[model samples]
Target: MKRVYAKEDVCIGCRLCEIACVVEHSESKNAIRTYKTEVPRPVARNVVEERGPLTFSVNCRHCDEPLCVAVCIAGAMVKDEESGVVRHNEEKCVGCWSCVMICPYGVIKMKPAAKKVSKCDLCNGRTMPACVQACPNRAIVYEER
Candidate 1:
């Protein structure tokens, strides 16, 4: 199964990954409308983190044994056996924050208004994740490794 991975050494901190993620998840799927007109804009599932001169994108690892899936009491977090993608079902979520607390990478985020948690779903339906495609430096890659 393929997963998204970050190449920290080559990352340039452009943050195009974040923007692409938001746009890809948006209802309009248009950058201009998603940023300028969309109300309650969709959040980026991936985040770019910086520490002084170092920067890299952070996202769910979709672990072989994801703790987030294990701790989700409402069974909202699930891992697809074939694809190895950890998916979050907002409708089934109970807003318990169990997944949030158990996520070791701190990638899962809580949606305060909806009382639901969100995480990287690998830009479902896309050939490649938005973040990996938007990365100008090829800092993010989707592959079996």
Candidate 2:
């Protein structure tokens, strides 16, 4: 199955991906409206890291044999057979951070306001992932390869 991949060499360390992710998941559909709040935390599924001249965004790999799924004691994480996407159930999550610990990429984060672990779900809808759409350098791309 295809997935979103990042080219670190091409990434410019711009946080448009982060902003887009938060806006996409915000209660208010409007991006400008969502930013007016005092908190203004978007909780993006992807995180960008800078290592000198290189930068990259990290997110869920949706691994074929995901350790997060195996480590979730609450059974909050599950993989979709049809789409090959790994998803989380906030209701089922116990906020133990087991999935976070198990994830090799360190992409998962706990949203304190939501009281649940949040990670990339590949958009899973009509719209493509916010990170992919927001990337200015075209470093992030969604494909079947």
Candidate 3:
């Protein structure tokens, strides 16, 4: 399965990944329109971490043996076989944060208002994720290696 990987050496920590992630998952469909205050808060599935000179975006790996799925007591997380994307079911979630605690990358975030967990799902139906599309530097990409 081809997965999205990062070349940390090329990353500038501009956070286009985070913006793209949030836009892709938004309900408004229109990225610009979704930014209005009336629209719900945008949640990012990928997050960037900065440590001095290095910075990189982190998201779900969709691991073959995912620890987050195993630790989710509410069974809200599932890995899609065809796409190798880990999806979250907000309805089933109990907001327990077990997945957050067990995720090695710390990519999962708690949606305080929604009372659920959110993470990258790779824009399952789209050709590419919003983050990948919005990145001007091509820091984030979807490809098969």
- How well does each candidate superpose onto the true structure, as a TM-score? 0.96, 0.92, 0.90
Instruction: Report the C-alpha lDDT of model 1 over 28-123, residue by residue, as the tens digit.
Output: 999999999988888888878899878999999999999998988998899999888898999999999988888888898878788888889999
Model 1: which ten-residue window has the lowest total lDDT? Answer: 109-118
Better of 1 and 3 by lDDT: 1
**Model 1: runs farther than 4 Å from truth?**
none
Give the least accurate 10-residue stretch of model 3, judged by summed lDDT: 31-40
Candidate models: Cα lDDT each: 0.90, 0.85, 0.79
Better model by lDDT, 2 or 3? 2
Residue pairs with colliding backbones in model 1 are: none
Winner on lDDT between 1 and 2 is: 1
Candidate 3 local lDDT, 6-97, one digit each (tens): 76777899987777677666776666766674245768888888899898776778888889989988888988776677878889999999
Clashes (backbone N, CA, C under 3 Å), per candidate, total 0, 1, 0
Q: Write the per-residue lDDT of candidate 2 for residues 18-119, one digit (tens) a residue.
A: 888888888885678778873746678888999898899888999998889999999899988778889999899988888888899898888876668998
